[model samples]
Target chain A: MTSTLKIGDVTFSKIPRVLIAKPGLDGHDRGAKYVAKALRDAGMEVIYTGIRQTPEDIAAAAVQEDVDIVGLSLLSGAHNELFPRVVQALKSRGGADIPVFGGGIIPDADFADLKRAGICAIFTPGARIDDIVREIHGILES
Target chain B: MLVRRSLDLNSLASQISGDTVLEGVEPWASRVRALSKALSLLENDPWLATRFLQHPALAKLSTNARVVGLTGLPGAGKSTLTNLIVGRLRKLGKSVAVLAVDPSSTDTGGAVLGDRIRMQDHFCDPQVYIRSMGSRGALGGVSRATRGAIRLIGLLGYDYILVETVGIGQSESEIVSIADTTTLVLMPNSGDDIQLMKAGVLQMADVYVVNKCDLSNPQRMLSELRANSEARGRGNEWTPPVLATSAAEQQGLDEFVDALQKHAEYEHDHPEGRAIKRKRVQTEIATNLLFILEREVQKMVAQVPDAEVNAVQAGQLPAMVVANRLFTEAFAMVQQGKIEKNST
Candidate 1:
């Protein structure tokens, strides 16, 4: 529970407390909930903020909830507009150090832009649950 | 039981000490981040949480915030009502902090806390701070960290602290001692009058709100609750008011708030107000002591030999006797050393 903990086979330098939120008008949350539950299963505390959240709402929640990572999932293809808004909101609100992660139907062409917009990691569809968990742990470790 | 790396409490304390602020700018956003980190410590690390809670800057905070706890059955609109109450309080220029508790998975000890969904309206408001908590196997509709979380929120200078409990059923009414004002939010037509009387949650409320009035008229339910209130034995001479509110239509919200305000006034005037606070401290101490004792017992049990376990399993030694012996030995160890390790 300190800066580092070893539980079972996994040793984390920092146990990740994440916020899995849906940004934009999309209401379907199969991917968000799946990743949320997957992270929960991997020994993480996930704040699932449910569907149709604005970037500001997501940022406010991430700060107030004190999460180290904000995971946004959107299938509406508005990731280009909404995802960076989340990063900008955080920067304006004194949470610039909190990282943002993306999941759900993002085309490969948009990956670099999303990364440039300050998304540390993106887990597309068919990304294995173990791989997603490993990537998250890797991010926290770095 | 776990020795965590200490946080920079001296630095955090210097920031929260409101002594230097007669007329100066406040670091509101940084305070929010500090509160979030403090709560995370409370939830995940016990040793550090005790130290943080005992720091003078935090420990010096008087109970200035009016803590109002809302509890009801699931889907009874506790979250929506909380949002409405936060909006109303902010309109009155009162800073608000909301602690919404959800249940944890019994299988994996994990939780998906989603109370922010209904509370998005206040997320953008700098005056309102909301945090969702996982119950983490604590009974009584709150997390083990709630005692510490509410204290931290108070220290951060919120005027109103709202604690929304997990959807509670009968007998999960620990909110009685956890809040200064307890409101039970029930939906219309939840059950018959007889069933309502049988419910354990019915007896412990300072106010009752029959929410979602747009779907059904609450006149019948109101009359029933009035009759029930009249029949009950009066303790402090304050009859719990039963009011109706519709979040969808925004009806009777002001009236409900008025009732809450009136109740607060009544409690303030009564000497029993301080009496309730004393009882709350006693209850919180007992709950926390039991939690710590459970941890110590687990430590002792881990050291028990397999032959002792085999004896118990083979019926040669009673498990109750072994438990009693373990408790005495472990508790004596705590009496000498364990408390010093964490409290320091």
Candidate 2:
């Protein structure tokens, strides 16, 4: 029955809050939902905003929820425009320190620009759930 | 994230002072960030949050803010109605903070806090602050962080605080203990009026809103709610007002606001007015104490070594012995330091 987590010196015993959102017109939530369920199973409180969320809404919700991490999933090929916009929005809302990671039909060529845009990490279709959870914990730990 | 400091005024002040927004400036995004960060402390480390709540900055907070609770069945448009109410309240020049609660999965402890989805209109408005909360296995609709968040919102000088419960239907009675006015939002043709009337969560509301009035048979539903609410009225006591609304069509909102104001006046003028406020304070105190104890227990459980757990599972160590050892350490830690600042 014990679900608390401890990493390094910090005990993530308090459920780490996370937000997984969709920031565009695409309604494909299978990926986002899977990760959300994964994170929840990993004992984190995950907030999922169904679909068609604006960047400002996502960032505002993240800051308001006081989430430790934010995960965005988009498949409309608009990651170039929207991912950085979400990062920018988070920064404007004083959430620059909140790690921004993403998933969906993103290409390998787009990774560097997106990272420069402030997306800390990206997960593609073949990415394992364990890797996502490990990467997120690593992000939170750092 | 760990609550990284002792949260004395100097520490909290320094935490926010690092931002460009100077101190004493209340109307800025940094203020929102500060409010949010405090809530994180409340959620992640309640032991530290207790110290923050006791700080001088919170000691002098204004006690005038009105707390309204919106509760009903899920998908009953609490968020849409709350958005409309926020729009109306802002037009009346009143600032509002909404704490929308969503249930965590008992299996996974994750939640898809979708209530804020409908409230996109007020996302960027400085006068309106909306936060989504996960229930985290706490029953009675709202999350455990709710009471502390209310205090933080009150400290930030919001004119009104809206608490949107998880709306588990029958058991969400805790709203009555937290909000000065509880608005029960219901849908039409649900037969909930007569059925849920005996269900207990239906009786706590100071106001009843049969939202989505555009649906078929809404008038009948409204009349049913009115009829049921009228039967609960006693001599000279404040009878809950049952109203109808179409949030999409923007109907019945002004009357809703007036009804809320009227109920507030009733509470303020009631012979036993202090009873409601006293109940709310009691709930807050109980929740804070629970938060501290539960968090300490979680920390202790996390610190249990794999060897001990394996020994217990293998029947090498008795469960009671292991539990006693854990409790002993947790109690000693509690005695040693009430706030484990920088333990992260």
Candidate 3:
């Protein structure tokens, strides 16, 4: 499900930074780590916030790191609550413009709800790394 | 699609200035939001970063925060030691901020910034603020943006600011000018004493820590470090003490911290030490100005006629003559306040 989603009109002369975080009590980090590595390989500065970060922690990190995108990998079924909380946290901190996306074991039924909660895109199981990279490029360029 | 709200410089600055927008009852959360916003602005906008340094609020900010620089080779456990120090400082109720500078990919200008991962133990602590900055094609291990970041963190009321360099040898001397105390972390059995001499790491260190002490005999390295310090006769007053630490095992950190404190105290008590710090700041400001001038000069040169550049390239014109002509024109335009208009 690809759509045009630019982070903002803010231009950066340096490499764009992306903060990939696991924002729930999910011990599974293989997907997060893989995406982080792929993003770094794709020439974006990637700061990986290790697993089990609270929404506040993720938002704070996203701001402090000055990330262009905040990517969350939540394998736990708590995306319904965790995802929106991160978006709310970013918004409260005056970072509403920062693009946020997620990937994990999310159910198809919750896609619209998560989208409504401010997640730009959601990658589920078997999402190819190249496709993810292309999607990120598309989003940033849009 | 996410709702698009335009973020203007004024609103961003207001968010960063700790004004009415951040006057929440919860001090910690509010401070975090304000500081994060300020740093985010500084990181993304070079103009804001420069203006922040010149802002009057910066003069009102406390300069008492000890800026400690940690430098080492790639595998020397600098981040582990930094994490340990952060834990120790937080235990004493002191706030700490870390600026971890990682090397940028020369080809792509990207970085993985994995140092923060090693220091993730403090991720949940509000008192600990860690930001990873890429070297961004700077020759020095630390980037130009670091000094501004340090000043901003100082204004954030942190008691200590630790700057971890890119771990490149020789070029790491830049930290000595910026940090009040520069600690060189080394692992035992890493190399011979000659390598240290060649890197001039001994001359740059205020305190040396032989990390990974549990792995090998550190006494030999320690004694050699001391002897080298003595041979250098650092400033004819203070001799850098070589301590040992096993960061993984969490041993010898107390002595290391004590040594750092003693150095900080010595710098505080001695007038010459203070003068030296002042001198370093003066040099830093001068260097930054020179860098700006160089960039401006490059921009002016880019506007030089291609025929003139080709003439110089083809040896039909002397390079120094062309440079002199360009400098004269640029200098006159500057005097007339027409440089920017002419350049464009």
DockQ scores for all predicted structures: 0.30, 0.25, 0.24
TM score of chain A per candidate: 0.88, 0.90, 0.90
Compared with the true structure, what per-residue lDDT tens digits does model 2 show for residues B232-272?
77775778898888998999999999999998888778765
Q: What is the docking quality class of candidate 2?
A: acceptable
lDDT of 3 by residue, B107-185 (tens): 7766788788777778767788889887877867788778878877787678999999998666558888899999999
Q: Summing lDDT over every window of 10 consecutive residues in candidate 3 chain B, give the lowest-scoring window.
A: B1-10
Stretches off by above 4 angstroms in model 1 are A1-15, A24-30, A41-43, A50-52, A76-78, A125-130, B1-9, B15-26, B233-236, B299-344
Per-candidate fnat, comma-separated: 0.37, 0.44, 0.27
Q: Count the backbone clashes (under 3 Å) in each candidate.
A: 0, 1, 0
Per-residue CA lDDT of model 1 for A4-57, tens digit only, reads 321112111223578999999999899899888888877667898888889988
Pairs with backbone N, CA or C atoms under 3 Å apart (clashes), candidate 1: none
- TM-score against truth, every candidate: 0.85, 0.79, 0.87
- lDDT (10s digit) by residue, model 1, range B128-206: 9999888877889988788778888888779989999999988888888888889999888877788678857787788
Q: Rank the candidates by TM-score, best first.
A: 3, 1, 2
Ranking by DockQ: 1, 2, 3
**Deviating ranges (above 4 Å) for candidate 2:** A1-13, A24-28, A50-54, B1-9, B13-27, B192-199, B272-275, B282-344
Report how far residue B140 has shifted in candidate 2, in Å: 1.5
Task: Give the number of the best model, judged by DockQ.
Answer: 1
**What is the Cα-based lDDT of residue B320 in candidate 1?**
95
